[model samples]
Target chain A: MNAILECKGLTKSYGGKKALSDVNLTIERGRIVGLLGPNGSGKTTLIKLANALLTPTSGEIRIAGMKPGTGTKKIVSYLPERNYLNDWMRVHDIIGLFRDFYGDFRPDKAYDMLKRLNINPNDKLKTMSKGTKEKVQLILVMSREAELYLLDEPIGGVDPAARDYILETIISNYNPEATIIISTHLISDVEKILDHVIFIREGQVVLSSSVDEIREQGKSVDGLFREVFRC
Target chain B: MLGKLLKYELKATGRTFMPIYAAMLIAAAVTKLISALTAGGSEVPEFISAIVYIMILMGMFVMTFVVMIQRFHKNLLSDEGYLMFTLPVEPWQHIVSKLLISVLWNLGSLVAAFLSIVILTFDEIANRALMLDLFAVIAEFLTIFGPTGSLVVLEIFLAGIATTVFGILLIYASIALGHLSNRHRTMASLGAFLGLTAFAQILFACLTLIPNVRVLQHYMDTLQESLQTSIALFHYVMWFTIGFFTLLSAGYFLITNHILKKRLNLE
Candidate 1:
């Protein structure tokens, strides 16, 4: 009941094909959890359900005791897998949007990050490169001081060096009182940062355990993930 | 929150629309300049100006509808839907912000078109004559229908607004339905639109038939009285349809909200 995120018997299907089924999970506050899975294995699906981007076919998902709704939306900082900012918007305009909509959003923090990254506030999103767009999205997502952060594929599109920078950003901006659920396939890159890892495949969790426990078992989360979801 | 959403929505959509609006006004100005330069000779510039003027008017009309759909689908149902629906605002507020701004822009477009026309044909004597003629006709209309005619005008205006809302809601509901599809979303939306239009046509036809054939059958016997009575009945029917449309728009809004809130399957 005290968990920041709870999903009970959550199922999502599209046109009779099940993307996720009978997902029962709980994420406690103040931990960076890795939601690791192969492509099309429902990592994004669960994250989307938590963010209310997609609704459950049955059962329910609750973030902070409330159902996925405008209320939960207020406290859930979501970085969708796609580039969601309007192309016409300037970098600062979107930053302003997050600030205006979310009371927890810190504009000063956002500006600092953008300035450090050398992204001009006046540049339109369409003018930025693909990698740069992802960075901007990350900045916007990290600037919010929310109770729950749902990041779907946060580092998927970036290069190796950019991925490190993004990880650094997530680490530095990590809110100890807030839970962070990061869904990504690059398990090794995030393994060191993850306190816990949920191994999901074929729309169900095969393993949910602490990173220490996995390491003590003489296997990295990445190795176990390969073993668990091997083709 | 709704105000903030409106501000952002307007800012996002204005970039697309303002340029077109400015082009329309510029076209109007260019047409006037061409007329002045031509000075009633060399018909080529005038002919080209007329085409440009007509094209700008048509472009504005078409762009208005395009911007409306883009605002709803691109902002709320496309990839950007990720950002939009995640905002701490309710779905109803989303609808209201878009609807209120849409109505405002619709009126703005109308005013812009009017101003463009006035600019294009701004000869003082002719405009004065035109205004006088328009007022004289309205005065005569008021004289015949008296207080009832005023009521009719008000009802017609209300009905016009209702129809615009109904059209927007239909598009919105269709877009919501289309989002339920996994692929070919544009085609799906078009199909939804056509399906709704078919249903609406049948409903309105039934409404028109029931009154004209059955309800007003008695008044058909008197030729002169039927004219006035028909006008009166038409007035009543306008109000009735307007009420029906309002309910339909509300229903569409509820459907759209349900899709966004509960059945949302964003791609």
Candidate 2:
């Protein structure tokens, strides 16, 4: 499979401090990859850089052979770490907005997912709980027929049951030819679904391997992560 | 696409503004009813005039507040921006949408306020033949200008509206530019606003000084003498104003696009 995302010597800094430093990564198509990292490990920074939300201090990144811009943003579905959906909008209005803005937005898919999740279309975002909002966001992102789905901690604020539903929704809804990158430190729960894993520590990738390869080495991804991040 | 953008833009702002519009209408109707009830005799009172003026001022204040708050929420805090930026549309579209909505609302409020004042002070206005005379004067002015000159006047009016929109965008761009910095976002916005105002003043000063140059002065005198008619002068001013607004709007658009595209940091 061709690499859908390529980053070479990607570096970002806030003021004088580094957020991501000299990081290199390549992600192929049709893979559910886990970006595992502890707090302040630059997962969000990397995701932002890839989404063109921030310009790199130095180095390069390419999403599907195009630099991050309106062009790349067109084919990339991004779920920001926080609730980026406007609180004043109704669920149906949000869907309408997405459909109007993105040519690849799948409203039927989103509506179906929301129905399955028992989420009302007319509910205001402000009234929904945080977990529900995250799920709504996830549903919208997953509904898109995008080339790459960049999810920053989709399950970070949700309960375990909702997390499972989010993961399942993501898995079931995504186009098989596309890639999904889920950035989170919750390894054990996501480990079962992630085909490949990239572990980031201190803004650098320390491990990149397939789940089967790690399991074949007589250790689970969770155990390896503990060993690698051991105090 | 512009139509769709404008539809949603109006919807977002109308959430707050619709209630205000309704209140203004109600106030206008109430004032009309009260004034009619109290005008038992032929004469209107000085106190009534004062009340009318106060009501007009209040309406204007409310309108301005609604505009400022809508802009702040839509451009700054609301997730509406996420949808805004992600649109296949360009940055200019966003600016245009906001500007159009602001102008539309302002015009609507001005008309409503004017109608309210008319109702409250109907005796005075009718006694003075304000409505009839005003329409007659406008007709006479248009007749003097003829069709082409009237068209120029219309163009000038539209340019004036565009300039007002550009002014609003400049404020937004200033704020966005200031927020691009990591430290002192508010202070930076204030500084940027002052700097932009100073730059505009300098530009105006330079334009004013151009006629002081010998060669330019001679050219201006020749042009002034040749274009002596009011219609000609109106055309010149209209074209000049259009050009000026077009330049300011271009600058505003460039700055806003650059900030949104590259320098955005959602703090």
Winning model by DockQ: 1
Compose the digit string of candidate 2's lDDT tens values, residues B125-226: 777677789879888877767767568667967896777676776777777778677788778878988888788778756765674365445556777555
Q: Which docking band does candidate 2 fall into?
A: acceptable
Worst 10 residues of 1 chain A by lDDT: A84-93
Candidate 2, residue A173: the lDDT equals: 82
- TM-scores for all predictions: 0.95, 0.88
Model 1, span B199-250: residue lDDT tens: 8888777877876575567566655766577776777788888988998888
DockQ for candidate 1, please give it.
Answer: 0.84
**TM match of model 1 to true structure:** 0.95
| iRMS, all models | 1.1, 2.4
